[model samples]
Target: MTRTLYLFGSAAPPVFDVARVIEDAQSGGWDVCLGLTPTAADWLGEGLDGLAALTGHPVRSSYKRPGDPDVWPAADAVLVAPATFNTINAWALGLTDRFIVGVVAEGIGKGIPLAVMPCVNAAYVQHRAFERSVRELREMGVTVLYGEGGFVPNLPGQGRKEAYPWDLALTAMDDLVPKREA
Candidate 1:
């Protein structure tokens, strides 16, 4: 049985590498379904169709119409990489204005294994809410990789897109929900 991974992304510079990340997850035996925040979808405009094709499911950035049949299979695990400060705080505060945040917030109550790797800068990290939000998510049983061993914040205006640790999030997700033996 193939494991399904709901890979959701926020609008961070690292989101530009999401195609490669999806491929990596697929190689690791995950049937990936991609979801994006509204801004992230806008940022990936013109390439959204390509992402949908790559994931074998629609790249959802908005809530589906009520009563609409679900498009993707049930998720066995979820990874929200490049989670922005807004997304992290919004999720912790239960503010579900964005599709990705809404789903991941619900994933918590649904008891779905979830992990997040924040892509924030040092300036953003100084905000009081940022640390509180990370703690709240961790207290909620979410695997948040945001410190020394995971994604250390870079200086503002000095982000190293190439250095974003996508592997750390993937590895943590794999640990949380191991792939089933076929």
Candidate 2:
């Protein structure tokens, strides 16, 4: 069975070209489902439709009305790239204010494999709350790709979106949810 991966993006510099990640994951055999934070969705501008086309499902940013049918397939795993400080903290707090957060919170509860690559600046990583949140998520079985050997924080004004490791997120998801060989 082809594994479905829900790729969630936050409002960070790397999100603008997140399609590259989707394409690479597709090549790796993930049936990608795109979802974005509201800010990320707005930042995408006209690229939203193209992203929906790329993933073959609507890029959901808001919760659909109750009773609405789910358009995307059941996710076998989730990858949150460009996970901002707010998203990391919010998710840890179990805040389901947005569709992205809702999915993440539920994914955690359901024991769905999850990988998060935070794209925060160096200063934010030093915050006590952020540090605690990362540790808490790690305790909850989240594959947080942060710090050394993962996503190194960039300087405040010198974000190297080009260096963001989208591939690593997929690799972590693979570690969590092994693909079934046909």
* Leading candidate by TM-score: 1
Q: If candidate 2 were superposed on the true structure by all CA atoms, what would the RMSD be?
A: 0.9
**TM-score per model over all chains:** 0.98, 0.97
- Give the clashing residue pairs of candidate 1, or none: none
Tens-place lDDT per residue, model 1, 50-167, is 9999999999999999999999999999999889999999999999989889999999999999999999999999999999999999999999998988999999999988999999
- Candidate 1's TM-score reads 0.98
The alpha-carbon RMSD values of the candidates against the true structure, listed in the order shown, are 0.7, 0.9
Candidate 2, 66-173: lDDT as tens digits: 999999899999989889999999999998898998998998889998889999999998899999999989999898899776899888989978888877788888
Off by over 4 Å in 2: none
Q: List the global CA lDDT of all models.
A: 0.94, 0.90
Say which candidate scores most in lDDT.
1
Give the Å error, residue 177, model 2.
1.8
